[model samples]
Target: MMITALANPKRFLDLSRTVSPWTCALAVILLGIGFYWSLFATPPDYQQGQSVKIMFVHVPAAWMGIFIYSMMAGASLVGLVFRHPLADVAAKSAAPLGAAFTALALLTGSLWGRPMWGTYWQWGDARLVSELILLFIYLGYIALWNAIDDPVRAAKAAAVLALVGAADVPVIHFSVDWWNTLHQPASILRLGGPTIDKAFLVPLLIMIVGYTFLFLWLLLLRMQTEILERRARSLMMARGA
Candidate 1:
């Protein structure tokens, strides 16, 4: 009901203008605290030592990479099935952000792995390969949106691609469990609960929340821009016609 009401561009713009600033402030505050706590407050791991600190950044990024793509897939589905006006806009706005997070996850994971696994990247690793594939999927989605001139046709095609590529999200998530990999199994979210120590877990959780809010703030801003750009193009066409 609420979402339907906000589907109107004016209403969405109004709401986003009011909310984005607050979300941005919250993101900055929470991320600042999380980074500080993770860097200074937490104790070093017995084995990995300072290297374990990378988990604070790497884990949240990996989670967001999967999460944002999942969100895009859902939005794409809504746009395709129900023909929601803003759904495609929302999905399109998220692709670059998702790609960045996925790339960060891979980069940080590689940095962490070099010390632990004695290699920067392992091509044979399922988790690594699946995650890399996710980045490519994001890039492909972005490219598909740009390649087509018609907005409706582009949305439809991109939605289909998003739906098909969603298969990789699960593959990336379960890769560690399904196959032997250098990447560790789920520690923060699992059947038995987080395996990490309280000192590490607290900051990690904070960072995750911070990252989510950051994504929200950025998504809202991006969506607003997309709407305005489309409106501008429409206005120019009307005047020219």
Candidate 2:
């Protein structure tokens, strides 16, 4: 019910304007706390030592990359099926942000891998390959949206691609489990509780929450801009007519 009410473009714009500042503020605060804890406070791993610090950044980015794509898929579903207003806008607004996070994940993962795995990147790793494919999928979705001239047509076409690409998400998530991959399996979320100790886990959770809030802040800003731009374009068309 609340979702339906917020579906109106004007309401969405108003709400976004009101809430974006708070979201940004919260993200900044949380990220600051998270980084401080992770960098200075958390004890280094006996095994990986300082190299483990990279996980604080890389893990959150990886989580956000998948998470944002899932958000886009859900928005695309609503747009393609129930024809929810602002659904396409939400999906389109999230794409670039998702791509950035995905790229960061790969980059940080590489940085982590160099000292740990003795190589910057290994193509043979299933998890790495799947993650790479996910980045490509994000890029392809954005490209498809830009390829079409008509906004309506672009949205519809992009929705189909988003839904199809969603199938790959699970593959990426389970790649470590499904195959013999260098990437670690689910530790925090699984049958057993997190294997990581409180010293590391606490900071990691803070970073994850901060990353999530940051994405929401950016998503709202981008969606508002899109809404305003479209409204302006419509006004120009009406004036010309």
Candidate 3:
């Protein structure tokens, strides 16, 4: 019911205007605290020492990379099936942000890997390779969106790409378990519960929430821009007609 109502562009714009500021404020506060706690409060890992601090950024980024793509897939599915006016906009708006997060994950993972694995990258590592592929998928989706001149055709093509690319998400998640990889298995989210200490877990969770809110804030802003651009285009077309 709520989604159906917000499907109206005006309502979505109004709601986003009202809510985006709050989301931005909350994200700032949470991220500020999370960073401070992660850098100062938590003790360094006994083995990895100071280098373990990278996990604070790397882990949340990796989670968001997968999460945002999943969200895009869901929105794409809606756009393709129901033809909701804003659905394609939402998916399209999220693509660049998802790509950025995925890129960050890969970069940070590589940085962390250099010290632990003695190599910046390993082609044989399933987790690493799958994550790299996910980045490529994001790029491909973005490229597809720009390849076509017609918005409708582009949206449909991008939607199909998003749906098909979603198959990589699971592989990335379980890569550590299903194959031999240098990446560690799930420590925080697992059937057996979190294996990490409260010191690390607490800040990590906070950072994750912060990142989510940040994504929401950015996504809303991007959607607003896309909507307004479409509106402008429609107006210009009407004037020409």
Candidate 4:
């Protein structure tokens, strides 16, 4: 009910305008503190030296990449089943952002990998391959939306694709353990608590919070932009008609 009400473009626009600045502020502050702690405050690893610092950014990005996709898929499902306009908007808004995060994860992982695994790229790794597939899924959703002329049809088709891609999130999550890959197993959120040292963990936790806020900040901006664009397009079409 609330989502449907906010689906009114004017209401959404007003809400987004009011909230965007705060989100941006939070994201910036968190990112600054996170990087400072990651680079200067965190202690070097017992094994990986300073290279382990990459995890500060990469791990959070990887988490966001998976987390955003799942959210997109869930929103897509809601749009498809409940027919909520905001749900489709949320799902559509998530695509480009999720793609960027996934790309970041892959790039940062490669940078970290070169130092740790002695290679920047690998073919047989399940986690890497699954994540790469995730990027493609995001792109495909965007493409599907653009290819269709009618917004309703586009949303339905894209929603289906997004839901299908949701299955891969689990695959990405378990890939490290399931496959004999170079990627490390889960820490922090795993059983028996985090195995990471406190010094390094603080920076990592800070970075994670930073990355999460950044995602929220970007998502709000993108969704608001999309809402405005759609409204403008609708107005233009009405005038032409």
Best by lDDT: 1
Give the poorly placed runs of model 4, Cα more than 4 Å off: 123-125, 171-194
lDDT of 2 by residue, 1-241 (tens): 8778888998888888999999999999999999999999988888778878888998899889889999999999999997886999999999999999999989988887787767787554555557788999999999999999999999999999999889766866577446644444422211112378878888999999999999999999999999999999999999999
Q: Cα-based RMSD of the predictions, in order?
A: 3.6, 3.8, 3.8, 3.8
Off by over 4 Å in 1: 171-194
TM-score of each: 0.91, 0.90, 0.90, 0.88
Candidate 2 error regions (>4 Å): 172-194
- What do the candidate models score in CA lDDT, each in turn? 0.87, 0.85, 0.85, 0.79
lDDT of each residue in 1-241, candidate 4, tens digit only? 7777886768877888898888888889988998998888777777777887788878888788888988999999889998988789888988888889989989987887777666786544556667787788788889999999899899999999888778765766576446643544332221112478777777777788888888888888888887878889999999999
Output candidate 3 Cα RMSD: 3.8
Worst 10 residues of 1 by lDDT: 185-194
- Write model 1 residue lDDT over 1-241, tens digit each, in one string: 9878978999999999999999999999999999999999988888778888889998899889989999999999999998988999999999999999999999998887787777788654566567788998899999999999999999999999999888766765576446643444433321112378888888999999999999999999999999999999999999999
Tell me the RMSD of model 4 versus the true structure: 3.8
- Candidate 1 overall lDDT versus native: 0.87
Between prediction 1 and prediction 4, the one with superior lDDT is 1
Query: Candidate 1 — which pairs collide?
Result: none
lDDT of 4 at 97: 88
Write one digit per residue (lDDT tens) for candidate 3, span 27-107.
999999999999999998887777788889988888898899999999999999999879999999999999999899889
